[model samples]
Target chain A: MRIGELAERAGTTTRTLRYYESRGLLPARRAENGYRTYDEGDLRLIQQIRTLQDFGFDLEETRPFVDCLRAGHPAGDSCPASLAVYRRKLGELDALIGQLQSVRTEVGAQLARAELEASAELPGGPEPRCELGPTAPQSPVGPNWEDER
Target chain B: MRIGELAERAGTTTRTLRYYESRGLLPARRAENGYRTYDEGDLRLIQQIRTLQDFGFDLEETRPFVDCLRAGHPAGDSCPASLAVYRRKLGELDALIGQLQSVRTEVGAQLARAELEASAELPGGPEPRCELGPTAPQSPVGPNWEDER
Candidate 1:
Protein backbone atom coordinates (compact mmCIF):
# COMPACT_ATOMS: atom_id res chain seq x y z
CA MET A 1 0.00 0.00 0.00
CA ARG A 2 0.93 3.63 -0.44
CA ILE A 3 1.50 6.19 2.26
CA GLY A 4 -1.99 7.63 1.95
CA GLU A 5 -3.61 4.20 2.00
CA LEU A 6 -1.59 3.13 5.02
CA ALA A 7 -2.37 6.38 6.82
CA GLU A 8 -6.03 5.94 6.08
CA ARG A 9 -5.95 2.39 7.38
CA ALA A 10 -4.11 3.50 10.53
CA GLY A 11 -6.54 6.38 11.18
CA THR A 12 -3.61 8.74 11.28
CA THR A 13 -2.30 11.46 9.03
CA THR A 14 0.17 11.29 6.16
CA ARG A 15 2.15 13.97 7.95
CA THR A 16 2.40 11.78 11.03
CA LEU A 17 3.47 8.84 8.90
CA ARG A 18 6.14 11.01 7.34
CA TYR A 19 7.27 12.05 10.80
CA TYR A 20 7.48 8.43 11.87
CA GLU A 21 9.53 7.65 8.80
CA SER A 22 11.83 10.59 9.51
CA ARG A 23 12.40 9.19 12.98
CA GLY A 24 13.13 5.78 11.40
CA LEU A 25 10.27 4.19 13.28
CA LEU A 26 8.64 3.23 10.01
CA PRO A 27 10.94 2.80 7.04
CA ALA A 28 9.40 2.18 3.64
CA ARG A 29 10.53 0.97 0.25
CA ARG A 30 10.10 3.01 -2.88
CA ALA A 31 7.89 2.16 -5.84
CA GLU A 32 9.28 2.48 -9.37
CA ASN A 33 7.83 6.02 -9.51
CA GLY A 34 9.43 7.04 -6.17
CA TYR A 35 6.33 6.67 -4.00
CA ARG A 36 6.48 5.11 -0.57
CA THR A 37 5.41 1.47 -0.56
CA TYR A 38 4.39 -0.69 2.39
CA ASP A 39 3.58 -4.32 3.02
CA GLU A 40 1.65 -6.19 5.72
CA GLY A 41 4.77 -6.26 7.88
CA ASP A 42 5.21 -2.53 7.52
CA LEU A 43 1.55 -2.12 8.36
CA ARG A 44 2.05 -4.19 11.47
CA LEU A 45 4.95 -1.98 12.60
CA ILE A 46 2.92 1.16 11.97
CA GLN A 47 0.03 -0.30 13.93
CA GLN A 48 2.36 -1.04 16.81
CA ILE A 49 3.65 2.52 16.75
CA ARG A 50 0.13 3.90 16.57
CA THR A 51 -1.08 1.82 19.49
CA LEU A 52 1.78 3.06 21.66
CA GLN A 53 1.20 6.61 20.45
CA ASP A 54 -2.44 6.37 21.51
CA PHE A 55 -1.20 5.30 24.93
CA GLY A 56 0.65 8.68 25.17
CA PHE A 57 4.09 7.41 24.22
CA ASP A 58 6.35 9.92 22.55
CA LEU A 59 7.74 9.13 19.11
CA GLU A 60 11.15 8.39 20.57
CA GLU A 61 9.66 6.19 23.26
CA THR A 62 7.81 4.17 20.62
CA ARG A 63 11.11 3.33 18.93
CA PRO A 64 11.70 0.31 21.14
CA PHE A 65 8.32 -1.17 20.38
CA VAL A 66 8.83 -0.52 16.68
CA ASP A 67 12.20 -2.22 16.90
CA CYS A 68 10.62 -5.15 18.73
CA LEU A 69 7.93 -5.51 16.07
CA ARG A 70 10.51 -5.23 13.30
CA ALA A 71 12.44 -7.99 15.09
CA GLY A 72 9.42 -10.28 14.50
CA HIS A 73 8.06 -10.24 18.03
CA PRO A 74 4.45 -11.36 18.39
CA ALA A 75 3.63 -8.18 20.28
CA GLY A 76 5.37 -4.84 20.78
CA ASP A 77 5.77 -5.30 24.54
CA SER A 78 7.05 -8.84 23.96
CA CYS A 79 10.56 -7.36 24.25
CA PRO A 80 12.32 -6.07 27.34
CA ALA A 81 13.10 -2.67 25.83
CA SER A 82 9.45 -1.94 25.23
CA LEU A 83 8.59 -3.02 28.74
CA ALA A 84 11.25 -0.65 30.05
CA VAL A 85 9.67 2.20 28.18
CA TYR A 86 6.31 1.30 29.67
CA ARG A 87 7.84 1.25 33.12
CA ARG A 88 9.54 4.62 32.65
CA LYS A 89 6.34 6.18 31.37
CA LEU A 90 4.41 4.73 34.30
CA GLY A 91 6.80 6.39 36.76
CA GLU A 92 6.60 9.72 34.93
CA LEU A 93 2.82 9.54 34.90
CA ASP A 94 2.75 8.71 38.60
CA ALA A 95 5.01 11.64 39.51
CA LEU A 96 3.00 13.95 37.29
CA ILE A 97 -0.23 12.80 38.96
CA GLY A 98 1.26 13.39 42.40
CA GLN A 99 2.33 16.89 41.44
CA LEU A 100 -1.05 17.68 39.97
CA GLN A 101 -2.80 16.38 43.06
CA SER A 102 -0.59 18.58 45.23
CA VAL A 103 -1.32 21.58 43.06
CA ARG A 104 -5.04 20.81 43.25
CA THR A 105 -4.88 20.73 47.00
CA GLU A 106 -3.02 24.03 47.23
CA VAL A 107 -5.20 25.79 44.65
CA GLY A 108 -8.33 24.59 46.42
CA ALA A 109 -6.99 25.97 49.69
CA GLN A 110 -6.23 29.35 48.10
CA LEU A 111 -9.68 29.50 46.54
CA ALA A 112 -11.35 28.74 49.86
CA ARG A 113 -9.24 31.30 51.70
CA ALA A 114 -9.91 33.99 49.11
CA GLU A 115 -13.63 33.27 49.15
CA LEU A 116 -13.75 33.42 52.91
CA GLU A 117 -11.97 36.77 52.94
CA ALA A 118 -14.26 38.11 50.21
CA SER A 119 -17.39 37.07 52.08
CA ALA A 120 -16.17 38.51 55.34
CA GLU A 121 -16.02 41.99 53.81
CA LEU A 122 -19.73 41.83 52.95
CA PRO A 123 -22.39 43.60 55.03
CA GLY A 124 -23.28 40.54 57.10
CA GLY A 125 -24.87 41.42 60.42
CA PRO A 126 -21.59 40.81 62.32
CA GLU A 127 -22.45 37.30 63.47
CA PRO A 128 -18.77 36.54 64.09
CA ARG A 129 -18.63 35.04 60.56
CA CYS A 130 -14.87 35.45 60.05
CA GLU A 131 -12.20 32.83 60.92
CA LEU A 132 -15.08 30.75 62.16
CA GLY A 133 -17.65 28.28 60.85
CA PRO A 134 -19.73 29.09 57.80
CA THR A 135 -23.47 28.76 57.35
CA ALA A 136 -22.92 28.63 53.60
CA PRO A 137 -23.32 32.26 52.69
CA GLN A 138 -24.40 33.30 49.13
CA SER A 139 -25.52 30.48 46.90
CA PRO A 140 -22.65 29.40 44.63
CA VAL A 141 -22.40 30.79 41.13
CA GLY A 142 -20.19 29.90 38.16
CA PRO A 143 -18.33 26.57 38.24
CA ASN A 144 -18.75 24.59 41.42
CA TRP A 145 -15.86 23.27 43.48
CA GLU A 146 -16.12 19.89 41.78
CA ASP A 147 -16.79 21.22 38.27
CA GLU A 148 -14.47 20.49 35.32
CA ARG A 149 -13.58 22.69 32.42
CA MET B 1 13.93 50.63 42.82
CA ARG B 2 16.03 49.42 39.95
CA ILE B 3 15.37 46.29 37.86
CA GLY B 4 18.03 44.36 39.72
CA GLU B 5 16.57 45.27 43.07
CA LEU B 6 13.07 44.43 41.95
CA ALA B 7 14.17 41.04 40.58
CA GLU B 8 16.09 40.29 43.75
CA ARG B 9 13.21 41.30 45.98
CA ALA B 10 10.87 39.08 43.97
CA GLY B 11 13.50 36.25 43.97
CA THR B 12 13.35 36.16 40.14
CA THR B 13 15.49 37.36 37.30
CA THR B 14 15.79 40.61 35.38
CA ARG B 15 15.33 38.56 32.23
CA THR B 16 12.05 37.26 33.52
CA LEU B 17 10.90 40.75 34.54
CA ARG B 18 11.84 42.01 31.11
CA TYR B 19 9.97 39.11 29.51
CA TYR B 20 6.93 39.92 31.61
CA GLU B 21 7.25 43.56 30.54
CA SER B 22 7.52 42.52 26.91
CA ARG B 23 4.39 40.48 27.39
CA GLY B 24 2.87 43.68 28.86
CA LEU B 25 2.27 41.97 32.17
CA LEU B 26 4.75 43.98 34.22
CA PRO B 27 5.75 47.13 32.45
CA ALA B 28 8.50 49.22 34.10
CA ARG B 29 9.17 52.89 34.09
CA ARG B 30 12.36 54.34 32.55
CA ALA B 31 14.71 56.18 34.85
CA GLU B 32 16.44 59.40 33.72
CA ASN B 33 19.69 57.42 33.35
CA GLY B 34 18.03 55.05 30.83
CA TYR B 35 17.49 52.26 33.40
CA ARG B 36 14.18 50.67 34.35
CA THR B 37 12.54 51.91 37.52
CA TYR B 38 10.02 50.13 39.73
CA ASP B 39 7.92 51.00 42.78
CA GLU B 40 6.46 49.01 45.65
CA GLY B 41 3.18 48.74 43.79
CA ASP B 42 5.01 47.22 40.83
CA LEU B 43 6.58 44.80 43.25
CA ARG B 44 3.12 43.90 44.56
CA LEU B 45 1.89 43.26 41.02
CA ILE B 46 4.94 41.14 40.25
CA GLN B 47 4.35 39.16 43.43
CA GLN B 48 0.76 38.60 42.40
CA ILE B 49 1.89 37.38 38.99
CA ARG B 50 4.49 35.12 40.59
CA THR B 51 1.95 33.58 42.95
CA LEU B 52 -0.30 32.68 40.06
CA GLN B 53 2.69 31.39 38.08
CA ASP B 54 3.61 29.17 41.00
CA PHE B 55 0.08 27.79 40.92
CA GLY B 56 0.68 26.60 37.30
CA PHE B 57 -1.11 29.50 35.67
CA ASP B 58 -0.01 30.70 32.24
CA LEU B 59 1.19 34.29 31.96
CA GLU B 60 -1.95 35.24 30.05
CA GLU B 61 -4.16 33.69 32.68
CA THR B 62 -2.51 35.86 35.35
CA ARG B 63 -3.63 39.04 33.58
CA PRO B 64 -6.90 39.26 35.43
CA PHE B 65 -5.15 39.04 38.78
CA VAL B 66 -2.62 41.66 37.73
CA ASP B 67 -5.44 43.87 36.57
CA CYS B 68 -7.28 43.35 39.83
CA LEU B 69 -4.21 44.27 41.87
CA ARG B 70 -3.59 47.28 39.63
CA ALA B 71 -7.16 48.37 40.27
CA GLY B 72 -6.16 48.72 43.98
CA HIS B 73 -7.91 45.65 45.28
CA PRO B 74 -6.59 44.21 48.53
CA ALA B 75 -5.62 40.98 46.74
CA GLY B 76 -5.54 39.60 43.26
CA ASP B 77 -8.63 37.42 43.64
CA SER B 78 -10.43 40.24 45.42
CA CYS B 79 -12.16 41.36 42.21
CA PRO B 80 -14.91 39.61 40.31
CA ALA B 81 -12.69 39.31 37.24
CA SER B 82 -9.90 37.72 39.25
CA LEU B 83 -12.41 35.41 40.89
CA ALA B 84 -13.65 34.44 37.47
CA VAL B 85 -10.10 33.58 36.48
CA TYR B 86 -9.81 31.43 39.59
CA ARG B 87 -13.04 29.67 38.70
CA ARG B 88 -11.82 29.12 35.15
CA LYS B 89 -8.49 27.81 36.38
CA LEU B 90 -10.21 25.53 38.86
CA GLY B 91 -12.31 24.12 36.05
CA GLU B 92 -9.22 23.73 33.87
CA LEU B 93 -7.27 22.04 36.64
CA ASP B 94 -10.14 19.70 37.36
CA ALA B 95 -10.39 18.74 33.70
CA LEU B 96 -6.65 18.24 33.48
CA ILE B 97 -6.52 16.13 36.64
CA GLY B 98 -9.37 14.06 35.31
CA GLN B 99 -7.57 13.46 32.00
CA LEU B 100 -4.27 12.59 33.67
CA GLN B 101 -6.07 10.20 35.99
CA SER B 102 -7.72 8.45 33.05
CA VAL B 103 -4.39 8.20 31.27
CA ARG B 104 -2.83 6.87 34.43
CA THR B 105 -5.50 4.23 34.69
CA GLU B 106 -5.03 3.12 31.09
CA VAL B 107 -1.25 3.12 31.31
CA GLY B 108 -1.43 1.15 34.55
CA ALA B 109 -3.68 -1.41 32.89
CA GLN B 110 -1.34 -1.68 29.92
CA LEU B 111 1.62 -2.13 32.24
CA ALA B 112 -0.17 -4.86 34.18
CA ARG B 113 -1.21 -6.67 31.00
CA ALA B 114 2.26 -6.47 29.48
CA GLU B 115 3.88 -7.66 32.71
CA LEU B 116 1.59 -10.65 32.88
CA GLU B 117 2.32 -11.50 29.26
CA ALA B 118 6.04 -11.16 29.80
CA SER B 119 6.00 -13.36 32.89
CA ALA B 120 3.94 -16.00 31.14
CA GLU B 121 6.60 -16.40 28.41
CA LEU B 122 9.14 -17.92 30.81
CA PRO B 123 10.37 -21.55 30.63
CA GLY B 124 7.90 -22.90 33.14
CA GLY B 125 6.84 -26.56 32.92
CA PRO B 126 3.31 -25.57 31.89
CA GLU B 127 1.73 -26.28 35.23
CA PRO B 128 -1.63 -24.56 34.62
CA ARG B 129 0.12 -21.20 34.11
CA CYS B 130 -2.03 -20.37 31.12
CA GLU B 131 -3.98 -17.22 32.16
CA LEU B 132 -5.46 -18.03 35.60
CA GLY B 133 -2.80 -18.19 38.35
CA PRO B 134 0.93 -17.75 38.95
CA THR B 135 2.59 -19.55 41.85
CA ALA B 136 5.94 -17.80 41.45
CA PRO B 137 6.93 -19.60 38.28
CA GLN B 138 10.39 -18.24 37.42
CA SER B 139 12.91 -16.23 39.36
CA PRO B 140 12.83 -12.62 38.07
CA VAL B 141 16.00 -11.46 36.30
CA GLY B 142 15.09 -8.35 34.29
CA PRO B 143 13.01 -5.45 35.49
CA ASN B 144 10.20 -6.65 37.70
CA TRP B 145 6.68 -5.41 37.11
CA GLU B 146 6.85 -3.64 40.46
CA ASP B 147 10.13 -1.91 39.57
CA GLU B 148 10.05 1.63 38.18
CA ARG B 149 12.55 1.89 35.40
Candidate 2:
Protein backbone atom coordinates (compact mmCIF):
# COMPACT_ATOMS: atom_id res chain seq x y z
CA MET A 1 0.00 0.00 0.00
CA ARG A 2 0.96 3.65 -0.36
CA ILE A 3 2.12 5.82 2.54
CA GLY A 4 -1.30 7.46 2.81
CA GLU A 5 -3.10 4.14 2.82
CA LEU A 6 -0.71 2.71 5.39
CA ALA A 7 -1.01 5.82 7.58
CA GLU A 8 -4.84 5.77 7.36
CA ARG A 9 -4.95 2.08 8.18
CA ALA A 10 -2.46 2.45 11.04
CA GLY A 11 -4.17 5.55 12.52
CA THR A 12 -0.95 7.52 12.36
CA THR A 13 0.25 10.48 10.35
CA THR A 14 2.31 10.08 7.18
CA ARG A 15 5.01 12.13 8.89
CA THR A 16 5.13 9.61 11.70
CA LEU A 17 5.43 6.75 9.19
CA ARG A 18 8.25 8.62 7.50
CA TYR A 19 9.92 9.14 10.82
CA TYR A 20 9.71 5.46 11.60
CA GLU A 21 11.26 4.69 8.23
CA SER A 22 14.06 7.18 8.86
CA ARG A 23 14.65 5.66 12.26
CA GLY A 24 14.99 2.25 10.50
CA LEU A 25 11.98 0.90 12.37
CA LEU A 26 10.23 0.43 9.00
CA PRO A 27 11.66 -0.43 5.62
CA ALA A 28 9.76 0.31 2.43
CA ARG A 29 10.57 -0.52 -1.16
CA ARG A 30 10.32 2.27 -3.75
CA ALA A 31 8.05 1.93 -6.80
CA GLU A 32 8.61 3.35 -10.31
CA ASN A 33 7.27 6.78 -9.27
CA GLY A 34 9.38 6.86 -6.08
CA TYR A 35 6.33 6.06 -3.95
CA ARG A 36 6.90 3.79 -0.96
CA THR A 37 5.32 0.35 -1.17
CA TYR A 38 4.48 -1.80 1.85
CA ASP A 39 3.55 -5.47 2.11
CA GLU A 40 0.85 -6.97 4.40
CA GLY A 41 3.64 -7.79 6.84
CA ASP A 42 4.40 -4.06 7.11
CA LEU A 43 0.89 -3.60 8.44
CA ARG A 44 1.57 -6.11 11.19
CA LEU A 45 4.91 -4.41 11.87
CA ILE A 46 3.20 -1.03 12.16
CA GLN A 47 0.67 -2.49 14.58
CA GLN A 48 3.52 -3.91 16.62
CA ILE A 49 5.27 -0.53 16.56
CA ARG A 50 2.16 1.22 17.85
CA THR A 51 1.67 -1.41 20.54
CA LEU A 52 5.30 -1.10 21.76
CA GLN A 53 5.07 2.68 21.84
CA ASP A 54 1.92 2.45 23.94
CA PHE A 55 3.83 0.19 26.31
CA GLY A 56 6.52 2.93 26.60
CA PHE A 57 9.20 1.36 24.43
CA ASP A 58 11.06 3.81 22.20
CA LEU A 59 11.74 3.19 18.52
CA GLU A 60 15.33 2.18 19.24
CA GLU A 61 14.21 -0.43 21.75
CA THR A 62 11.66 -1.89 19.31
CA ARG A 63 14.21 -2.69 16.58
CA PRO A 64 15.23 -6.15 17.81
CA PHE A 65 11.60 -7.19 18.11
CA VAL A 66 10.87 -6.12 14.53
CA ASP A 67 13.81 -8.16 13.31
CA CYS A 68 12.51 -11.27 15.08
CA LEU A 69 9.01 -10.93 13.59
CA ARG A 70 10.41 -10.59 10.07
CA ALA A 71 12.43 -13.81 10.48
CA GLY A 72 9.15 -15.87 10.60
CA HIS A 73 9.12 -18.57 13.27
CA PRO A 74 7.07 -21.80 12.90
CA ALA A 75 6.27 -21.63 16.63
CA GLY A 76 5.27 -18.73 18.92
CA ASP A 77 8.42 -19.10 21.04
CA SER A 78 10.73 -16.11 20.42
CA CYS A 79 14.46 -15.57 20.58
CA PRO A 80 16.03 -15.69 24.05
CA ALA A 81 17.31 -12.15 23.38
CA SER A 82 13.68 -11.01 23.00
CA LEU A 83 12.98 -12.32 26.50
CA ALA A 84 15.96 -10.30 27.77
CA VAL A 85 14.54 -7.21 26.08
CA TYR A 86 11.22 -7.70 27.90
CA ARG A 87 13.10 -8.15 31.19
CA ARG A 88 15.11 -4.95 30.63
CA LYS A 89 11.98 -3.00 29.74
CA LEU A 90 10.27 -4.33 32.87
CA GLY A 91 13.21 -3.13 34.97
CA GLU A 92 12.99 0.33 33.40
CA LEU A 93 9.25 0.45 34.08
CA ASP A 94 9.85 -0.50 37.73
CA ALA A 95 12.49 2.22 38.09
CA LEU A 96 10.21 4.80 36.54
CA ILE A 97 7.39 3.79 38.90
CA GLY A 98 9.75 4.05 41.86
CA GLN A 99 10.90 7.52 40.86
CA LEU A 100 7.37 8.82 40.30
CA GLN A 101 6.17 7.26 43.56
CA SER A 102 8.93 9.05 45.43
CA VAL A 103 7.97 12.35 43.79
CA ARG A 104 4.31 11.80 44.71
CA THR A 105 5.26 11.07 48.34
CA GLU A 106 7.49 14.15 48.67
CA VAL A 107 4.95 16.46 47.03
CA GLY A 108 2.16 15.08 49.21
CA ALA A 109 4.26 15.71 52.30
CA GLN A 110 5.09 19.28 51.25
CA LEU A 111 1.46 20.07 50.50
CA ALA A 112 0.43 18.69 53.90
CA ARG A 113 3.05 20.81 55.63
CA ALA A 114 1.93 23.91 53.74
CA GLU A 115 -1.69 23.26 54.73
CA LEU A 116 -0.68 22.73 58.37
CA GLU A 117 1.25 25.98 58.51
CA ALA A 118 -1.50 27.89 56.68
CA SER A 119 -4.20 26.63 59.08
CA ALA A 120 -2.17 27.17 62.28
CA GLU A 121 -2.07 30.94 61.58
CA LEU A 122 1.58 30.83 62.60
CA PRO A 123 3.34 33.97 61.46
CA GLY A 124 5.05 32.66 58.30
CA GLY A 125 8.58 33.46 59.16
CA PRO A 126 11.49 31.99 57.26
CA GLU A 127 10.74 28.28 57.25
CA PRO A 128 12.07 27.11 60.68
CA ARG A 129 15.02 26.15 58.50
CA CYS A 130 15.43 24.96 54.91
CA GLU A 131 12.81 22.21 54.39
CA LEU A 132 15.47 20.53 52.34
CA GLY A 133 18.53 20.53 54.52
CA PRO A 134 22.20 20.26 53.57
CA THR A 135 23.04 17.57 51.02
CA ALA A 136 20.34 17.99 48.41
CA PRO A 137 18.47 14.96 47.06
CA GLN A 138 16.95 14.49 43.59
CA SER A 139 13.21 15.20 43.42
CA PRO A 140 10.81 15.56 40.47
CA VAL A 141 10.18 19.11 41.64
CA GLY A 142 13.15 20.06 39.43
CA PRO A 143 16.64 21.40 40.19
CA ASN A 144 17.47 20.96 43.88
CA TRP A 145 18.15 23.88 46.27
CA GLU A 146 21.87 23.39 45.65
CA ASP A 147 21.26 24.58 42.09
CA GLU A 148 18.44 27.01 42.89
CA ARG A 149 19.72 28.98 45.89
CA MET B 1 25.30 43.96 47.70
CA ARG B 2 26.72 43.13 44.27
CA ILE B 3 25.22 40.35 42.17
CA GLY B 4 28.18 38.10 43.04
CA GLU B 5 27.71 38.76 46.75
CA LEU B 6 23.95 38.09 46.56
CA ALA B 7 24.58 34.90 44.58
CA GLU B 8 27.18 33.74 47.11
CA ARG B 9 24.84 34.43 50.04
CA ALA B 10 21.88 32.76 48.31
CA GLY B 11 23.94 29.80 47.09
CA THR B 12 22.79 30.41 43.50
CA THR B 13 24.67 31.13 40.30
CA THR B 14 25.01 34.74 39.20
CA ARG B 15 23.56 33.72 35.82
CA THR B 16 20.46 32.32 37.49
CA LEU B 17 20.09 35.47 39.58
CA ARG B 18 20.33 37.52 36.39
CA TYR B 19 17.86 35.23 34.64
CA TYR B 20 15.46 35.69 37.55
CA GLU B 21 15.89 39.44 37.28
CA SER B 22 15.13 39.28 33.57
CA ARG B 23 12.08 37.15 34.25
CA GLY B 24 10.91 39.70 36.88
CA LEU B 25 11.24 37.11 39.64
CA LEU B 26 13.97 39.28 41.19
CA PRO B 27 14.48 43.06 41.20
CA ALA B 28 17.92 44.65 41.19
CA ARG B 29 19.40 48.13 40.76
CA ARG B 30 22.16 48.83 38.27
CA ALA B 31 25.24 50.57 39.60
CA GLU B 32 27.54 53.06 37.76
CA ASN B 33 29.59 50.14 36.36
CA GLY B 34 26.32 48.61 35.10
CA TYR B 35 26.61 45.84 37.67
CA ARG B 36 23.41 44.64 39.38
CA THR B 37 23.07 45.20 43.12
CA TYR B 38 20.63 43.50 45.49
CA ASP B 39 19.67 44.08 49.10
CA GLU B 40 19.47 41.74 52.12
CA GLY B 41 15.75 41.22 51.47
CA ASP B 42 16.68 39.91 48.04
CA LEU B 43 18.37 36.96 49.76
CA ARG B 44 15.10 36.06 51.47
CA LEU B 45 13.29 36.46 48.16
CA ILE B 46 15.79 34.15 46.48
CA GLN B 47 15.24 31.59 49.23
CA GLN B 48 11.49 31.86 48.69
CA ILE B 49 11.97 31.47 44.96
CA ARG B 50 13.89 28.26 45.59
CA THR B 51 11.17 27.06 47.94
CA LEU B 52 8.39 27.65 45.39
CA GLN B 53 10.41 25.98 42.65
CA ASP B 54 11.01 22.98 44.90
CA PHE B 55 7.24 22.72 45.22
CA GLY B 56 7.04 22.43 41.41
CA PHE B 57 6.14 26.03 40.56
CA ASP B 58 7.83 27.17 37.36
CA LEU B 59 9.55 30.57 37.14
CA GLU B 60 6.39 32.07 35.62
CA GLU B 61 4.13 30.76 38.40
CA THR B 62 6.51 32.16 41.03
CA ARG B 63 5.93 35.74 39.81
CA PRO B 64 2.85 36.34 41.95
CA PHE B 65 4.56 34.90 45.00
CA VAL B 66 7.58 37.18 44.41
CA ASP B 67 5.28 40.16 44.01
CA CYS B 68 3.51 39.32 47.28
CA LEU B 69 6.84 39.16 49.10
CA ARG B 70 7.97 42.46 47.55
CA ALA B 71 4.74 44.19 48.62
CA GLY B 72 6.00 43.75 52.18
CA HIS B 73 3.50 41.82 54.30
CA PRO B 74 3.43 43.09 57.92
CA ALA B 75 3.70 39.40 58.78
CA GLY B 76 3.49 36.10 56.86
CA ASP B 77 -0.25 36.15 57.64
CA SER B 78 -0.68 39.47 55.87
CA CYS B 79 -0.27 38.11 52.33
CA PRO B 80 -3.51 36.36 51.39
CA ALA B 81 -2.21 36.19 47.83
CA SER B 82 0.73 34.08 48.98
CA LEU B 83 -1.69 31.50 50.35
CA ALA B 84 -3.55 31.50 47.04
CA VAL B 85 -0.29 30.91 45.23
CA TYR B 86 0.42 27.92 47.48
CA ARG B 87 -3.07 26.61 46.80
CA ARG B 88 -2.57 26.91 43.05
CA LYS B 89 0.75 25.07 43.33
CA LEU B 90 -0.93 22.35 45.35
CA GLY B 91 -3.51 21.85 42.60
CA GLU B 92 -0.81 21.51 39.95
CA LEU B 93 1.11 19.04 42.11
CA ASP B 94 -2.00 16.97 42.60
CA ALA B 95 -2.65 16.79 38.84
CA LEU B 96 0.97 15.78 38.18
CA ILE B 97 0.77 13.05 40.80
CA GLY B 98 -2.44 11.74 39.27
CA GLN B 99 -0.84 11.55 35.82
CA LEU B 100 2.21 9.72 37.07
CA GLN B 101 0.09 7.32 39.06
CA SER B 102 -1.98 6.42 35.98
CA VAL B 103 1.11 5.80 33.89
CA ARG B 104 2.61 3.68 36.65
CA THR B 105 -0.51 1.51 36.80
CA GLU B 106 -0.59 0.91 33.05
CA VAL B 107 3.15 0.15 32.82
CA GLY B 108 3.02 -2.13 35.85
CA ALA B 109 0.15 -4.14 34.34
CA GLN B 110 2.01 -4.50 31.04
CA LEU B 111 5.13 -5.72 32.84
CA ALA B 112 3.15 -8.34 34.73
CA ARG B 113 1.44 -9.61 31.58
CA ALA B 114 4.75 -9.79 29.69
CA GLU B 115 6.37 -11.77 32.48
CA LEU B 116 3.49 -14.24 32.56
CA GLU B 117 3.48 -14.76 28.77
CA ALA B 118 7.28 -15.11 28.66
CA SER B 119 7.23 -17.90 31.24
CA ALA B 120 4.36 -19.87 29.66
CA GLU B 121 5.14 -22.67 27.18
CA LEU B 122 2.88 -22.64 24.11
CA PRO B 123 1.89 -25.61 21.91
CA GLY B 124 3.57 -25.69 18.50
CA GLY B 125 1.31 -24.55 15.57
CA PRO B 126 -1.14 -21.72 14.95
CA GLU B 127 -2.04 -20.19 18.30
CA PRO B 128 -5.27 -21.77 19.61
CA ARG B 129 -8.32 -19.55 20.04
CA CYS B 130 -8.79 -19.58 23.80
CA GLU B 131 -11.03 -17.49 26.04
CA LEU B 132 -8.12 -15.07 26.33
CA GLY B 133 -8.43 -14.77 22.48
CA PRO B 134 -5.90 -15.23 19.71
CA THR B 135 -5.11 -11.52 19.38
CA ALA B 136 -3.76 -10.24 22.68
CA PRO B 137 -4.27 -6.56 23.39
CA GLN B 138 -1.48 -4.48 21.89
CA SER B 139 1.20 -4.01 24.50
CA PRO B 140 4.88 -3.08 24.70
CA VAL B 141 5.49 -6.80 24.24
CA GLY B 142 3.71 -6.78 20.89
CA PRO B 143 6.48 -5.14 18.88
CA ASN B 144 9.00 -7.39 20.61
CA TRP B 145 6.88 -10.31 19.40
CA GLU B 146 8.94 -10.16 16.24
CA ASP B 147 11.70 -11.61 18.32
CA GLU B 148 9.32 -14.18 19.80
CA ARG B 149 7.47 -15.15 16.56
Top TM-score hit:
1
Q: What is the lDDT of residue B140 in candidate 1?
A: 52
Candidate 2: C-alpha lDDT:
0.64
Best model number under DockQ: 1
Error of 1 at A139 (Å): 31
lDDT of 2 by residue, A20-69 (tens): 87766787899999999998788888887787777667887676567656
Residue-wise lDDT of candidate 1 within A1-149, one digit each (tens)? 99999888888899988877766678778999999999888888888787777767878888777767776777777767777787788888888878877887887887888888877777674543222112222235722323122
lDDT of 1 by residue, B32-145 (tens): 999999999999999988888888999988877776676567787776666666777788888888887888788788778988876776656354222212232223562222
For model 1, the superposed segments whose C-alpha errors exceed 4 Å read A124-149, B125-149
Model 1 clash pairs are: none
TM-score of each: 0.79, 0.65
Error of 1 at A129 (Å): 21
